[model samples]
Target: MTTPREHVRNAAGFALVWVAAKAAHRVRFRTMGSVPRTGPVILVANHLTMTDPLAVARVAIGHRRFPHFLAMQEVFGWPGVGALARATGQIPVARGSASAADALESASERLDQGQLVALYPEGRLTTEPDQMPGPARTGAARLALRHPEAPVIPVGTWGPKQGNGHIWHRHTACLSVGAPVDLSPWAGRSDEAAAREVTDAIMAAIRAEIAQAKQMWHAR
Candidate 1:
């Protein structure tokens, strides 16, 4: 359960991030379907750019859900950013290290506590020249298998590219949130094959949402 103090801290963090994100980009957000207002949920999204977390957070905050993101470990080492990440309860992922599994464990605990946990199954910013989502790692699928009760929601973001060196130039960003994925078929299955299948389905859902977000961005 979130303490009153933590709630206040999270709210402050959200406000700061929202304002900063707005100043950096013109963000357009939409919810294609309803996201649960309460309960534990696992949000999976395409990894577009380093700033994609901010776009996703905007959507989560709009629904009154304070998101605890599983972010890259290096981000936790940055000066002021690291302090805020820890203060807001963000989980750091030590990619390619044995300690990487610790992030999933921490995310599971957050879900058990009925908090929203957001992850990018892609694991890193997409190298795709077109900015489409790439193949996903199985951490998200494994987490879903462990907590079948928690809904897995797919989110898509567009307009944030990897090589944009213009930090001062405001860019247009679009976020689209999809409904909870149906995991009943994979229920009670925890094999490697099951994880692969689940991950593929989750990635597919995210890809579809990204297409929708891209259309929204173009229409804007």
Candidate 2:
């Protein structure tokens, strides 16, 4: 449901993002599909670089919605970056705080209120090409189970390619989005095994999306 208010907000956010991406002048690349025009959705993606999230978000904002991300507390405390981060609806995580209950509360509040959010399950930035994704903390699973019906869209970027003042403007920046992932299987699971199973399943879905995106992007 793209309410009148959200519609207005999306349009405005898109404008700002468009300007910023254009300024970066990176040749923005994308494949897969567009973010749904209307829905309570969760976005999942790889964390290969510090800018990985932002690189992925460039494509997300251009789609039919505004994206809210889960920002680490450190980033949330920075000066201008933090201000800008909050303005974009970033859910800040005070990691090490009782299994991230605070962030979950914030995510639930936003999703229940009808918003799109981006998450990096790796819990931190990536530095290598061969690392088999950091063990996901399962907080994302907890978040999704809390809202069993929201659509979870997985996104993957080919690269910011090492250093980056701007990649979105460079023609080489490529991104791919997977269809919305559903975690209904864990909707009612009560055991630890069931929980880990569900989390691994979700992680698999995200991994496939990322691998496909990376392959397709680099092939071109």
Candidate 3:
């Protein structure tokens, strides 16, 4: 039941946390393309670690924008994070719901109001830095097509925000955003069989961008 008004509130709250986190951690977010400054937009990014949101938030503030994260219900279940998620307008979805209808409705409403929605199509963090993004879901594609006029930005993030033990364990991390992909052509094809085509294309584009970032990160 996240409405456009909810996302606006979430954006405001995220801004405060982003400011504190970035300033305290000295983490920097870099962008490879001009982030759409406004409109019903979607930011599709690779999941590196739990701190992925921090990186995205920093970049958003740096770019002078606010983006709402489509988070998992588990994160919101935590007492503190749950409270934060509710206050900031972050969308929390169940791990395996009957249909992603609730999430879609919430996202559609936000997009209709011309707000940016950030989603991780992979459904979870990447254990292997180079593993091809697990077959992505079509939610993001559908969301993009819902707001065809808005930008469906494909983004790739590499490295770690601080720890270097694994996904959450890198001394430093970098983010790279690729050109936006428009999915208006596949908007109405909601059937699973038909949606797979759209999902594949988006996943391919995201993987391509992640590959580019992976190479750059390893080279350094």
Candidate 4:
């Protein structure tokens, strides 16, 4: 059950996100597929820039689901930002540390609580010259395999790259939400090989969504 304090926090968090997102870019969100109103959800998206999380959050908020992101541990060290992150339940990932796996466990716990967990399976921003999504890091796949009942939704975003050099300039960002991927074929498989296959399937779905999002970006 959500407490009154939690509801207040969520409202404040969503308001902050809206202000920051609108101040940075003119975002156009399109939901090509449905996001389950209630349940555990794994939202996987392609990472383009550091601002990508804001875009994804905008989409999730539109669907009435407040996303808890798995962000780098360094972000949790910032003064006010860190405090807010902790309060809003964002998972911190300590990459290259022994405690790295702990983030996944925390994510699993959130899933068990029926919360929406969002992650960039690529692990980092895409380095592709064309800005296409890179390889998956298996974390998202592992979560999916661990919780087979949760739907893995693919989200595509474009236009944030245009604001990289001109942070003050507001550019148009286009985001498209895709349907949940069918992980039935790899259900109950936690092996590395299975994880890689599942990640590949999930990335393919994300790429398809990106392709559509790109078209929308250029047309606007």
How well does candidate 3 match the true structure in TM-score terms?
A: 0.80
Encode model 1's per-residue lDDT on 1-220: one tens digit a residue: 5689977997788887777667777888889556788999999998767776877877888888888999999999989788878988899999999999999999999999988999999898888888887778999999999999899999988887675465567788898889888889998999999999999999989998999999999899
* Every model's TM-score: 0.95, 0.82, 0.80, 0.94
Tell me each candidate's RMSD, in Å, in order.
1.4, 3.3, 4.0, 1.6
Considering only N, C-alpha and C atoms within 3 Å, which residue pairs clash in candidate 4? Answer: none
Ranking by TM-score: 1, 4, 2, 3
By lDDT, the best candidate is 4
What's model 1's overall lDDT? 0.87
Q: Where's the lowest-lDDT run of ten residues in candidate 2?
A: 162-171
1-220: candidate 4 lDDT, tens digit per residue: 9899988998888888777767767888778657998999999999887776877888888898899999999889988778877877899999989999999999999999999999999888888888898667999999999999899999888888732565667777788899899999987789999999999999999998888889899899
Candidate 2: segments with Cα more than 4 A from true spot: 1-12, 23-34, 129-132, 162-171
Q: Order the numbered candidates by lDDT, best leading.
A: 4, 1, 3, 2
Judge candidate 3 at residue 90 and give its lDDT: 78
Residue-pair clashes per prediction, in order, are 0, 8, 6, 0
- Cα lDDT for residue 162, model 2? 48
Report the C-alpha displacement of residue 177, candidate 2, in angstroms: 0.9
